[model samples]
Target: MADEVKLHGLAGSPFVCRVKIALKVKDIKYDFVVEDLINKSADLVKYNPVYKKVPVLVHNGNPISESLVIVEYIDDVWKGVSILPHDAYEKARVRFWAKVVDDKCLPALFKAIGSHAQEQAVAEAHEQLQFLENELKVKGSKFFGGDSINLVDISATFIAYWVGAAEEALRITLVTKDKFPKLKEWSDNYINCQAVKDVLPPREVLVGFFKSRFGKA
Candidate 1:
């Protein structure tokens, strides 16, 4: 199928998972190509020459790199319920949250997982999560965009699954129910939603992998 859509991604990557969820939501069928990040496939390198990363979207042979960029491209091309809001201001807000997920939340999360200054890293991650909690409070929305998932929710897909895995792997909890009730509720909702549940990597496997990669806290 030369004209079929294809995706290059790595297993258990939340960035990649974002695309999967969006494609499922949009009802767009795509061929998924799992890449070996370590070895780096020729096609993966060739298609995404700049970043040389996975989660590349090949639509009828045209390649698009970066997960969020690919997701937006998907939304634009497909005809369905949009991942972004229709209103100009609302769309900007969604993009803002998405940027926060990529620039702040994810970096803080990885820092908590892999940094030597464990306590400081955890505190920093907590701060970022708290910021998101505030956003939810201000919007008074169940999920990032509302009752249904949207681009902001998709952008923070890691929080839905990988955060718990990282917590179990490290023996430290960042998203305790007490500290982040609304955030925790949102996380539960996001993971249990039909669109997200099937695509999530098993928590046990994620925990094991992270445990081996980062070792016990």
Candidate 2:
């Protein structure tokens, strides 16, 4: 019998989009279980009891929680496409950058959007983004993975897509063409990729969603 795969996720979620992009890149056929985070769902709760979050990947009755973990799991299990690097050092570097995106960049980015200390938050976000800008400049590749999307690129999907929506909704700019040219170029190339484009939420939809949460600018 074939394995059954289902992704329980909320629309416009960058984390969820990460898993969706990974699955799309691997050409995995799976069912999408749209989750209402407000009410929550029994299956979502059952699948991920710890956090009770969306983006739980259920495969053949087993559940995997956390978006990055799920993406790694999919990459490990599936063939044909490679999300992580084959070399040990390169793979570790990719994982390191992915963690930086989640731990350092994401918090700063969101805090810049929502924190009361606007100046401090924005400054911190700029610092974090500068790290990425430097990495892109040093690598001199269209993507963190070089020539294609990889785990690092997947992890930074929020910067590529959601930042624009957040900027529009809040009438602020975090990433600018002149300020971080390499990062800006990377975002353009990443979002325009066929697989990435296929899984991304519509820009207007994301803007509307962000507006609803943060109030109109």
Q: How high is each candidate's TM-score?
A: 0.95, 0.97
Clashing pairs in 2: none
Candidate 1 residue-wise lDDT, 1-217, digit = tens: 4358999997788889999999988888778898999899999999999999979999988999999999899889897878999999999999999999889998998888786337888899889989899998887887897988899999999987898888888777777889988889899899998888978888888998888888844
| Backbone clash count for every predicted candidate, in the order shown | 0, 0
Q: What digit string (tens of lDDT, one per residue) describes model 2 on residues 1-217?
A: 9989999998889999999999999999999999999899998888899999979999998999999999999999998779999999999999999999999999999899875327889899999999999999999999999999899999999999999888888788788999999988999999999999998989999889877878644
TM-score of 1: 0.95
Q: Give the lDDT of residue 126 in candidate 1.
A: 87
**RMSD of every prediction:** 1.7, 1.3
